[model samples]
Target chain A: MNENRNNLKLGIFITLGTICFVAALYLLGAKQNLFGGTFEIKAIFNNVNGLQKGNNVRYSGINVGTVKEIVILNDTAIEVNMMVQIDVHEFIKVDAIASLGNDGLMGNKLVNISPGGSRSRTIEVGETLLSINELDADEMLRRLEETNKNISLITSSLVGIVDKIDKGEGPIGTLLNDNNMALDLAKTMTNIRELSFQTASLSQNLSKSFNNFQSSENTIGMLMNDTVLAAEIRTVVDELKNFGTNSEKISSDLNTIVSGIKKGEGTVGTLLSDSIANDDIIKSIDNLQKGSEAFNENMQALKQNFLFRRYFKKLEKKK
Target chain B: MIQTKGQFQSAKRFLFLVGDIGQFTLRFFREGFHKPFEWKEILKQCGEVGYRSLSLVGVTAFIMGLVLTIQSRPTLVEFGAESWLPAMVSVSLIREIGPVITALICAGKIGSRIGAELGSMRVTEQIDAMEVSGTNPFKYLVTTRVLATSLMLPLLVIFADTIALYGSFLAVNIKGAVSFQLFFNQVFETLEFSDLIPSILKSFFFGFIIGIIGCYMGYNSKKGTEGVGKSANSAVVVASLMVFILDLIAVQITDLFYEL
Candidate 1:
């Protein structure tokens, strides 16, 4: 019994120790997501950026999987297999983009999946997702180099512009450098000041003359200042207004008469509007012009004749 | 001439001692397999070596953990990585400190006990008497004790590591609070199989060295009562030194295989 008790005690101690060790192992395995409803997926990358097996796979900043394997497919590409939890599969889509990310600035490399659109098909077991390579340090450095070149170009151009300005070459430089232009501007400003001063004095004199006119000392002033003269001017303005109204009525009558003539409503209207009458008038004017021309021709013939020439010369001497 | 003769005698003695230990190691391997397997003796030894030494190992490991945490706190806090306390302490304890410290403690406690017990038995002619009584003394004594130490050390180290991590957890909470789950998560996250297996494997070597050294010293002890004391003392000293040496070799081997 004593031996059995000691053995039992020893056995229990050993068992407990072994349990602790195994528990540690189990916990570690669990942390690595070893025992789970896991599904495998593949992502191919031109470069994995030092991503290793057992690195975390995060979705929306939460760890949902682990990198299971990394196989170099060729000189240019590598295939990374990941074991993700099955429950998170609903969140992952076929169009999800996998990219390499770091845990922290100097921490381990992990794969981060950008959640795909809701309308896209969900990712299934063993399906491949598109991988996007992060901008590596070298790529960033290369871009920085280009930016530096551009900055240098801009800076050099700026320096050249500054140099031109310093040399008084451009419009800005001329504005700064032209002493004669500055003096001319100053003289023009002084002339404008004097003109304004003279205009002010002339306005003051005009106001004095207007005041004198308003004192009832001059005829024009009396005409402006006297109440009776003001009444007469108002009466004249009223009569003018009446005459303007009468003239407007006469213009309206004339417009009516013209419109009646256009429509051939009266005798004069018929005469003006009738096309035959207009033809007769044009014929009469033409006959009159012909008679005048005939008369001039006869006079010229008579002057050429000896008898009429002497008679015309005596008439001219009597006039 | 006298000094030369003394030097030559010592050199011969050293070579004979080496030869004797080599032969003893071989005989242990040979007889260990041919056993009416000493399960009972092994159990008793497990109790003696592993259970009895727990307090000493545990206290030392706890102190080591606490001290390591306290010492490493300032540096890690300076780096703003105070949160890494559990992981760092766990790695150091599991990979190196826990195993080596426990093994050394066992060397001092168990090694000395085995050497003295066997030495006293030898000095008192009990081993010879047991042999005369038609029992295989080597199997019953050296094999059981050696196997027991070898088997028990790893388990002890596991216990030590657990206890030390607890101490570290306490120390971590002294300055700041960290949940047990988070602490353990950090620990397991930082630890790899490479860190664990190599350290546990090396403890077995340490155990074997301690057991074999103790057994050898005790078996080859001379000059009666004075020799028993000397055997115990020399066993502890040699075993402790061998623990460090074996640890160095184990680290190198592990690095070569795992790191490369």
Candidate 2:
């Protein structure tokens, strides 16, 4: 009976111990993705940032796998093999990106697998995923140093500009500081206002003259506005135009006649242009003069007789 | 001159003790596998060593875990890492505190018990009677107790670790809120096979050391009640000291492998 009790106690103790151990192993193995249907995929990176085997592989922030192994391919590339649960296979595609990240502020390194575009196929077993190198501490520090230098330059420039402005050295500073310039600018503005007032008055006067020209009572306005006078004037102008037309016709006929004479084509033209006829005319006049002279002699002889002398005396008394 | 002579005598005695232990270890290996196995006695001793020590180890482990959590809370809270309570406590218990403390406790309880029992047996000539009767006293007493301790200490450590983690979960709830499932998940999340298996392997060595030292002291005890008391006391002291030394060696070895 004692042996039986001893056996029972030992059995229970050993059983409990075994249960504890198995439970621990199950939990730990589950965490490590040890007891699951898993698939392997590769990621090649320029730098892993201290990532090691057994580190977690997360899919869009969910822990789905562990880093199975790491191989240094060359100086600049490293190959990391990861074992992920088969369940998340569809969520990870062929074009998925893998990058290194920390678990927390100061935690272990892990591989982050981000999903790709929906059009891409799911990643195949043992396929290598694309890697994007993260901004590591060194790179961040370098960029920060550059930014600091730029900020320093900008601040220096700002200080120079501010100093110049404080010293009243530039145009803006002079505008702010010079009271005499301000007074001149104010006077210029006032003069411009006075000139605009005078221009407005001149415009008003011109407008009044235009109104007077538009009135129907004045002669100039009547010329512009009286319809009856305008029509009469138009009739007179029409008659003058007709007269001018008639004069033009008469002058045209005269021009034709003159041109006919100048061309020596008619009797008057022959009389004017014939040099032989002119000589004959001159000879006839000479003959006539001679006959008149002879007749005058005969008359003188009759006057010497009594009857012709009495008739000549009576014609002179009548004159 | 007398002082020099005394120091030299002490050195000689220490060397002699080391030689005796070495011889004793060799003799155990040689005679241990001989026929007439002590299976029934080993089972009985397993009950006495493992099952009987479970309650005490469990209670000690619980207090240890609770105290550790409470003490570590302020520092972790200062860093805003209060969420790491479970993982931190679990790793601490399983890695170093759980196995080593369990070994020390066993060295105190089981080691002294084995030493006193065997010492009394030797003092009363019970072992001699067994030898006269052609029953091997070393095989029956020393081998069975050693075997039982070696087998039981690891089981005890596993129990202690589990109970301690439970205690830590309770303590975590004292000042904060954490579900049992979440706390245990956090604990197991940080615990890997590497953290677990090496510690467990070291506990086996711890057990072996405890068993061997106790048995050595007790089996070779001088003939008297005083000698029996001395054997029990020396067993506890030597076992405890050996536990710490073994733990140091275990940590170094674990570190070396972890480096790789």
Candidate 3:
């Protein structure tokens, strides 16, 4: 009885221990996808950043698979084979990007399978995924050092530019530094101000003159505004134009007469042009004068005769 | 000259003691596995070794886990890695602390008890009487005890590891909040077969050392009450030392196998 009880206790102890061990083992194995339906996929990388077999393969930040194998293909290529759970396998398309990343800061390295573009086809078994190699720590630190050097160079150049500006060494510098130029500028500004004042007063006086000249009392104003006088003056000017035309015609006729006389074309032209005719005209004029004097003497003799004396006395008394 | 001679005699005796233990171990393998196997006594020893030690181991494991968590929390909090507390503590306990602590406790409690019991029996001529009666005392006592420890210690370590993690969960909730499911999930997430298998495997060696050292010290004890006391004292000390040495070796082998 005692032995049986001891054996029973021992059995219970062993059974409980086995239960714990098996439960823990099952959980860990399940995490590794030991019992799950899974498919394999491949990726080639230049570097894996120390990712190893059994590292998690996460899809879009969720762990969907685990790395099954890591093989060094050549000097530059590493082939990573992953066994992903079947349920999530559909989400990983042919163009999925496989890269390496960390679980947390200072955590284990893992394979990150980011989903591909929207239109990519479903992934096939054992198909190689496109990969972007993670920048290792040494490379990142090297780039940071280069950037620091460049920043120092940029800062030094900026300091030089600032110093040059402080010393007034360029076009803006000259404008700042030359005292005589400032004085000339001030004088020019003063002259412009005085000229503007004078211009304003001159414009005012010109406007006043224009106003005065616009009234009809002024001659220029009458010439501008008297419509009737202007029309009369226009008529006189027209008559004067006619007189000029008539004088031109008369002068033409006189010119013709003078030319005819010079040519000795008529009797008056012959009397003027022929010297013998002119002398005969002078002799006839002298005989006609002598006859007129004899007539007058005869008439006086008849009035003194007695036969007509009474008739002459009666005509004189009637007068 | 006299002191040198005495020092040389002591060294020679120590060498002879080692030789005796080795010879004894050889004899145990040769004689212990043959017919008339003491399965009943082995089962009894397993009860004594496994069930009797369970509470002590469980309580010690709990305190160790709780204390470790509380101590580690401030440092992890400094790094803002308090979320890593479960993984970090579980790995520490499983990989190093659980096996070593449980073995040490057993070495003190079980190793000394076996040593003193066997030593008193040997000193009182009980072992000699068993031999006269045609019973193999070494097989009946030493082999069964050793086998019991070898088998039971791994189970004890498994129990201790589970209890320790429970204690750590409670400790984590002392100042902060974490669900039991989440705590366990985190614990199991970082634990791999590599971490789990080697720890439990090393525990078998720890059990073997505790059993054999205690049995060896007691079986070869000098006569009298003083000898019994000496054997018991040396068993605990030597078993504890061997447990540490074995732990060091286990860690080195694990590292090599895992390529850590």
TM-score of candidate 1 to 2 decimals: 0.72
Query: Model 3: clashing residue pairs?
Result: none
Minimum summed lDDT over a 10-residue window in model 2 chain B is located at B251-260
Clashing pairs in 1: none
Order of the predicted models by TM-score, top scorer first: 3, 2, 1
Best by TM-score: 3
CAPRI grade, predicted model 2? medium
- Superposed model 1: Cα runs more than 4 Å off: A138-288, A292-319, B1-19
lDDT of 2 at A271: 66
Q: What tens-digit string does per-residue lDDT give for candidate 2 at A1-319?
A: 9889889989999998999888888888998887889999999998888888899999999999999999999999999999999999998999999999998887789999999999999999999999998889888999999999999999999999888877888997787678888898899999999999999999999899888988847888888888998999999999999999999999999999888878876887766778897788789999899989999999889878887888989888999
Tens-digit per-residue lDDT, A1-319, candidate 3:
8878878888898999999999989988988999899999999999888888888999999888889999999999999999999999778899999999999999989999989987889999989999998789989999999999999999999898777767877766665667887788789999999999999999999888777767736876676778887898899999999999999999999999989999997987898999999899888898778787887787677789888778888998999
TM-score of 2: 0.72
Residue A235 in model 1: shift from native, Å?
35
Better of 2 and 3 by DockQ: 2
lDDT of 3 at A265: 76
Stretches off by above 4 angstroms in model 2 are: A138-319
How close to the true structure is residue A55 of candidate 1, measured as C-alpha lDDT? 87
TM-score of 3: 0.73
